[model samples]
Target: MPRVTIKEIARRAGVSKGAVSYALNGQPGVSDATRARVLKVAEELEWVPNRAARMLSAARSETFGLVLARTAKTLSEEPFYMGFIGGVESVLSTKGYALTIQVVPDLETEMAAYRKWSAERRVDAVIVVDLRVDDPRVPLLQKLELPALVVGDKSLAGGLTCVWTDSTTAMTEAVEHIAELGHQRIARVAGPPEHGHVWMRGQAFAAAADRLGLTGTVVHTDFSGDEGASVTRQLMTSGPDRPTAVIYDNDLMAVAGLGVIHELGLAVPDDVTIIAWDDSTLCRITHPTLSAMSHDVVEYGGRVAHHLFELLDGAEPAAHLNSTPKLQIRGSSGPPPA
Candidate 1:
């Protein structure tokens, strides 16, 4: 459909273009009756303001950007981002703002997106995710002077505004939950070690395992279901002393791991128990519902968006700790097999 223009509105309302502009903009030049008439005509025509023109004139795009450096396949299968983005939109839509999401294959392309958005004044702010140690994006975002909110621990935020959950604490709790159930051998299927959260969780898992006198193993994956299944097979068959409990970084991988374990003719909890991060719907609906480090991920995303809006409102850059994910026990986790 063609865009409804001010001229078209003016023609229909029996007014000049200048009068239409004044009426639409709620300027002093337009009388109450004229404004009402112009609005009615615009409503009839389904007219909407040109965002680009509004941005140029007002110097505010009212748009937020998020760039994901991950494969489309992985992203489609992962439920965390879906819930997170929904949370972000829940806030953005209420405020009449927009979100621009770009999925790139690597960090370089993701960086390019930030630069382009900043250069073009395309977004009022950006949300940075999957932060790594000494993340290049942090410095680039700083150099570009782009307003950004980092979605990682403050240690990895490089003094930027951040909203994060305590992965270390949560990992400790998860490990303790499994340990209490008499599982001495535990394994974690984590995401890329480069991710700050994964690294933090890995360290915490190791420390907690050591503190509890348990054997701990960690394997890295791309947070894909295929890799999750493959790694589970390897872990289960690699030796006689296999881990009795396995933890996965996301719901997709954990679900995949469950299938692999079943394929190997092992029963959940009775043989190898499973725990997954992010208590998504998949976790709940599985044959044996997964145990998970449960947090309100949608609310977590909303909090991040809220903090970004605060920063845009001239609030100081600071770290806000969201809730730590609590271990939610379900059918998949129990005492190891006798």
Candidate 2:
């Protein structure tokens, strides 16, 4: 049977369209008797809310939405994104769904996009990333009854199904590797503190350094190469207690730091060792071939998307632990200079 419209309900209920609307929406304009009559007619005609049409039709919108709160510059240069998106598409393509991405300036705009998509019925589900502690999107998305896959630990997911990596283990391993290589002092050029993963890594780094009897500090950055270079310059040129090893949050920043080291006539793994969190092709092709905590980012993304599909099928999937990034030693990391 076709979806019953308000006009049909009005005709069958012997009421005007406005009265039908008022009755269906529980507005006060309609009398009690009229409201009952309208509801009865709606039930008899099998009328349902517009939002339920897709469910009853057993047809998906065939679109999944991803709203990014990153700048265009970051999006353009970030190698991680290409691999992740490729993996998501690998899954979505087989399922006949298209991924729609929107880049927004901040969390506000990102949330607004979700609202617009929900109201317009532009997507059947959405993927959320960059979760912060006490994230506001959790409650709002739940209220909208939108299916969402959170791309971070459950600490920020507010009980939503999630796929997360063991960043704490990765960060700790990086520090332990450097420590084993005789790096006494260490620092991290970390992403914004508001992000849950960044905070987890920061905490893990400090804990690992403490356990190994090393000094560790973290400085926040916007995950840009320029910012990474500037931070590297400052840390390397600082006081006598300056770090002998530095960890970067991404490959781009690590590469930028390498350039800064070169300009300062410093040698990697001798003057100061470096480790990058993400091991991309860029990490492999760099001059010194940066040491990194390595994982298959594309496969990680694919796993996340897979969980989202489960959620769409009414499986309230539990939080998933993908895997910890293993430390891959390379030319850029070694013992501190004698």
Highest TM-score against the true fold, candidate: 1
- Residue range with the least summed lDDT across 10 consecutive positions in model 2: 51-60
Off by over 4 Å in 1: 1-50
How many angstroms is residue 61 displaced in model 2 relative to the true structure, after the best TM-score fit? Answer: 1.2
| lDDT accuracy of residue 138 in candidate 2 | 90
> How far does residue 31 in candidate 2 sit from its true spot (Å)?
48
List model 1 lDDT by residue over 1-338, tens digit each.
47989989999999999999999888889888889999999998888888778777757888999999998775578899999998898899889999998899899999999999998999999999999999999999999989999999999999999999999999999999999999999999999999999999999999999999999999999999999999999999978799999999999999999999999999997999899998999999998999999998899889988988998999999999999999999999889988
Residue 119 shift from truth in candidate 1, angstroms: 1.5
Residue lDDT tens for model 2, 149-182: 8889977788888889999889888988988888
Residue pair clashes in candidate 2: none
Quote the lDDT for 296 in model 2: 90
Q: How far is candidate 1 from the true structure (C-alpha RMSD, Å)?
A: 2.4
| Range of the 10 consecutive residues with the lowest summed lDDT in candidate 1 | 51-60
